[model samples]
Target: MERPIDFSRDRRMLCGICAHQWLVDLEWIDRWEQSREVCPGCGTTCEHENAPRVTVDPDDLALDDDKIAQLAWYHTSTLPDWPTRDFDPAADLTPETRRMMGGSKRVAAWAARQRGKALHVGTYESAIHNMLRRMRDQADHGSQFYLYRVLLMPSVVVREGWLIDPGNFVGDVVLDEVCPPGVDVARYLNYHEDPGGLSLALGRGAVAGVQQVAVPLRDACNNDWVREAVADLDGASDALVPATGRLGRFMRPSSPRAFLGRELGAALAGKLPVNLQDQFASAAAFDEGDNPMRWARRTSCLFDLIVVPLRALAELDRQERRTV
Candidate 1:
C-alpha cells in the first residue's frame, strides 16, 4: 500500500522483550525494498507486515526522573553509543526523585546491595531473555497483554518509583497469514522463519524436544522414588527395597543434565534411610535464588533433578530390552 509508514516523523524501535525504545534510522525504510523487513543489526527476518508504522503527538506524563537516570546508566554500560538517559522532557530528576536518588548514586548503590553484583547486561539476545521471564511458551495464544521482561540490568534499581511511559509510544504488531496456527507468545523472540507462515515459531522445535525428554524422565523419577519410599514405609521392619530397579538406560539426542545428571542418579540409588531426608537434597545442595528445591516440594525437586538422567538411561534400557 502506502508503505504503511509515515516519513515525516522521527523513528523509534520498541523491543517487545526489553520494552526499551531505541531510535530507529529513518533511512532504513528508504534503503530496504518494499517486499521485506529485517533487523538492521542481526540478519533476523522480520516480515513485511511486522514493522511499526504509526506515530502520534507526544502527550507524555511527567517522566520519572530516577527511572530515566537508570536508563542512562544502562545505556552508558550496555550500549554506550545509544542516547543518554536524561528525559527529553526534563533536564534533571523530579524534586521527589532527588530525594530518592539521595543527591549522589543512590540507585546504583542500592542495586548492588540487593543483587550482590551489577547484572552483566550483555548481548541483545540475553537482554531480551532476562526481561521476559517466560521461557518459550509452546501452547499459549490470543493473549492481549504480552509480558515483555525489562531487566533492570544497570547497577541501579529505582525502588521509590516506577518507569512512566505516559506518551504511550505506539508500534504495530506484524502478523500475517503465512505464520503457523500455534505460536509461542514470548515477546523477546523475534518470531522464527517457519515454512507454514507461523511468524513466531522460532526455537519452538528445541523447546518441544526438551519437553519430550524431560516429561518421561520427570515422571519416571517421581514414580521410582515414591515406590521405594512407600515400600519402606509399609514395611517399617524391613530395609527399603525399591519396588523396581533403577531406570536402566535412557537415550536422548543431547545431554540435558550434564551438570547434575549422574549425581542425581547416584543420590536416588543410594539409601537415604528415612523419608525425613529430602529426596531432593541434591537440588537443594545447589539452591540459588528462586530455589526450586525450597519453593517446589521435595517430590518435585527430586523429580526435576532426576528426570533428564532417568529419561536418558531409561530410553537406552528400553531399546536394549526390545533387542532381547
Candidate 2:
C-alpha cells in the first residue's frame, strides 16, 4: 500500500516581492502551488510553483549545522588567470596599488567597501549576476570570468543578521566607541560600511577556500537557458528610451536592479526556489542602484555562510563539472 500524504506538517513560504517568510500547512501549499496566494507582509501575488521553502523556523532565519554542511557556495572572478591564491582587502584601497597590481579597481574597491576582508560569495545565480554586472558596468568585453565552487570547514561558525540593517548589528562596538570627537556619525558609518571586514578584523576567523577546478565563462554562457535570458534582457534594455520624467524614472525601465531581477528570475527559474527568484527580482527593483549586497544578503540568509580554510580545501578532478 502507498503511504498517505501528510498535509499536517508545516511548510515554510517566502515572498519574493518582499523578503518576508511565513509558515503554512502542506495542504495550503498544495492548493497555493496549483493556484495563486497572496503574501501577508507585502500583499504581492505569490504564484510561482517553485516558491522558496525555508528549511528552518521562519522566525529564526539562521542555518543549523546540517543545512550549512549540505549547501554548496559559489564565488566568481574576472581575473585572466585561474586558481586565485588568496583574498587581500588592504591592497584594494589604494588606487595606485590596484592599478600597479593590474586588478579591477571597481571590484577591489567594492569588496573592500562592502565585504571587507571576508570574500563576497553567493549562490550560483548571484555569482553569475555579479559577473554580468561587472561586464556591463566596466564594459570589459575582452575579460574572461571564472566560477569557483567554495568548500567550508566543518567547524566554521555561521552568524545571523543583516549586515546593513542597524537592528541586526552583530555586536562589534569598536566603531561607536572609537568615533573621533567631532566626526559626523553618518559619515563615519558610511566610511566603515564593511561589516565583513570588521568581523574579520576582529578575528572572527571565518574562512572559505575555493575548489581548484574553475568553470570558465564560455561554459556558463553556452548554457542555452542563460543565453536566451541574457539576450532577452539585452534586447529589452536596448529598446527602452532613457527616462526623463519622475513617472518614467519611477517605473525604472533603465535601472540595473530591474534589469538584473528580470534577467536572473528568467534565467534560474526552475533551478532556484521561487521565493529566491522573487527575492533577486525584488532586491534588484528595490536596492539602491546596483548594490549587489542586497541580493547577496538574501542568498546568504537562505544558504548561510560557508567557511573553509585554505589547508582544508581538497583538489577536485578537472573532468568533473557542475552546471549552473
Candidate 3:
C-alpha cells in the first residue's frame, strides 16, 4: 500500500533557471522560512522571492460516487448498447469491440464495484487515489495501452528507435495534459486556482516524437468505442474542472457518419492530433460564459485516463535509468 504524505505544511519553490517548481517539506519550512532552498532540477539556493506559500492536503482531493457514476455513464456512451448503469457485464459487447478494450472487462467491473460501494466521500477519494497509483505501477511493465495496441495491432509502434513515437502509424494518439512536468493532477484538476504549490511532483518524461494534442470536444469523435468506454470508467469529476458542461461531451453522441469522424476516428484509425491548447483557446473565444482555465482543467481530466500507458512507460524508463 502507498503511504499517504502530507501535502500541507509545506512551501512551494521554483527554480528560476530550469523553471522547475517543487514543494519543500515542512521539516525545512522554518529553516528556509527566512531564505530559499536548493532546487532539485537546478542546484541553486533559490531566493525567498522564488518560493511561494501554498497548501495541499488530502482535504483538497475530492472524488465521490456521483462523479464516478457520471463518468461511468460517459464510458457507457462509448459503447453502442452497453447498459449505462453503475455496473455492466458487457454481455452484449461484440467480439471485435471487446478486443479494442484491451480484452479485459476487469476495469469496467472494477468501476462498477467502486460505484456499488456506499463509502463516504473520503473513502471513495482514497480508493480512487490508490487505484490510480496501482494503475501507474502496472503501466511501467508496458501492460497498459502499449500492450493492447500490440495485441490488436502489432505493427503500430516502432519496436526500437531513438525517435520513439507511440501513435505514429495510425495517429495512435493518447490524451495528455499540456502542463509541464511537476504539476500535480490536483493542481491541474483545480486549474491552478490556488496560490500554487511550492513543489510539484515531476512529470515522467514523454517519449520522443510523441505529440500531446488536445482535440476540441466538438471535433473529437469516438474512434474506438471500447477505448473511450474504458477511459470513462476511471474518470474524475466535472465539478473539479468546471469549465465545459461535462467531459463526456468531447466524445459522446457517437459520430459514426460525420466527416469529422474521418479525422478523429476510433482509437484504431488514430489520425489527426488535436491541439488541446488551441482547442481551449477556440472554446474560450465563443464560450462567453465558461472559464477557459476551468474548461482546460475539465478537458484535461476528461482525457486523463488515456495517458496512463504513456505515464507507465515514463516510470519504467526512470527506473531503468536509476539501475544503470
Candidate 4:
C-alpha cells in the first residue's frame, strides 16, 4: 500500500503565481509527471518544474540558530551533553533550562498578540500525554512494559515535544486477531479501566526487532509543529507555559479571591476550597498534596485556558458559513 500524505509533516510544492505551497494528495507522482496538477494557491495549471517554487521542507522550519544556540547554552551550561541523556526524574534543571523555561511562558501571550489568529501550542506535558495516547493506539499488540509506560508516564515526563513518528515509533507486532471483538478501540479510549488489554496488544510490538526513534529533548522546542504554528501566526504574537506547574502559575488568580467564580472552582475542586490562595499562590502550595482531584482541577484549568481563545476563532468560521 502507498504511504498516506501527512499535511503536517510532508512537503508541498509552491506555486509560482501566488507563492502558495500545496500538497499533492490524490494522485501518483508518475501520473503527475505526465500531467500537472492545478495550483491551489492560484488557479494556475502548470507542470512541477514550471511552477518555479520548490516544496517546503519541514526541517527548515526548525527553531532558528539563535534559539538553538540558546538551547545549546542551556544544555552545555548545565550538563556536558544534556541532549544525549534520556529524561530522568532525579535530574536537576541547569540554568539554561530555567532560562528556556522563562521563554516558554511567553508563548501564549505571543500567540495572543498575533493579528487575527490565536492558538494554544500547549506544554510538553500535554504533548507527552498526547504521545502516550498515540502509543496506546499504535504500540505492539501486547507489551506490558509499553502499557505501564503509557499509564504511568502521563505525569512523569521531565520534558516534552520530542519528535517521535507515530507510525514507526513502536510495535513488535500487530495483534489484531488477539484483540477481542469490539475491545480494541475501547481499551485505549476508556483506558482508565482495562489499559492492560491495550498494553497486551502493544506487548508484541516491543520485540527485539522493533525500534522506536525519538528526536532529542533539546530539539523538542524546535519541532516542526511549533515552528509551523509560529510561522502561520505571521508575527502576530505568542506565549508559552513550558510545564504544567507553570501552566498553573499562568492561570493563578491575582487577588485573594478566586477569579474562576467561587461556585465553579468549588465544583471543579470537589470539596476542596476554591481559594486562589491555596491553589495558585505558589508552586509549593499547589503541589503540596497528592489529592488527585486537585490535580484534575489544575489540568482542567489549563485545558480551558487552551480552548477559550479558540471559541472566537470558531465563531468566525460559523459567521462565514452563514454568509456563504
lDDT of 4 at 272: 23
Candidate 2 segments whose C-alpha is farther than 4 A from its true place: 1-62, 80-116, 160-205, 212-324
Q: What is the C-alpha RMSD of each candidate to the true structure, in Å?
A: 23.1, 14.2, 21.6, 24.7
Which candidate should be chosen as best, given lDDT against the real structure?
2
Q: Regarding TM-score, does 3 or 4 come out ahead?
A: 4
- Local distance difference test, each candidate: 0.27, 0.39, 0.28, 0.27
lDDT of candidate model 4 versus the reference: 0.27
Tell me how far the alpha carbon of residue 12 in candidate 1 is from the true structure, in angstroms, after superposition: 50
Q: What is the per-residue lDDT of model 1 for residues 1-324, given as tens digits with 9 covering 90 to 100?
A: 001111123345443333334444434533433435555444333343444432212321112323322321100012221112221222345768756667546755653343321112122222222222112232111111111112232232222221111111221222221122343211111211100010111111211111011211233344454555434333333222233335523432222222233334345534322211232233223212222222223334333323333333334334311100
Clashing pairs in 2: 50-274, 152-307, 153-307, 153-308, 207-308
Using TM-score as the measure, the top candidate is 2
Worst 10 residues of 1 by lDDT: 192-201
> Which model, 1 or 2, shows the larger TM-score?
2
Better of 3 and 4 by lDDT: 3
lDDT tens digits by residue: candidate 3, 1-324 = 111222223445545566776676544543454455455675555364543333333233223212221221011011222222334446567777677765666647644543432111112122222223333332321112211000011111211111112222321122232222332111112112112211111111211111112112223323444344334422422232322466665743332222222222233212112212222222222122233333334333323323322432233233311100
What's the candidate order when arranged by decreasing TM-score?
A: 2, 4, 3, 1
Query: Where does candidate 3 have its weakest 10-residue lDDT segment?
Result: 146-155
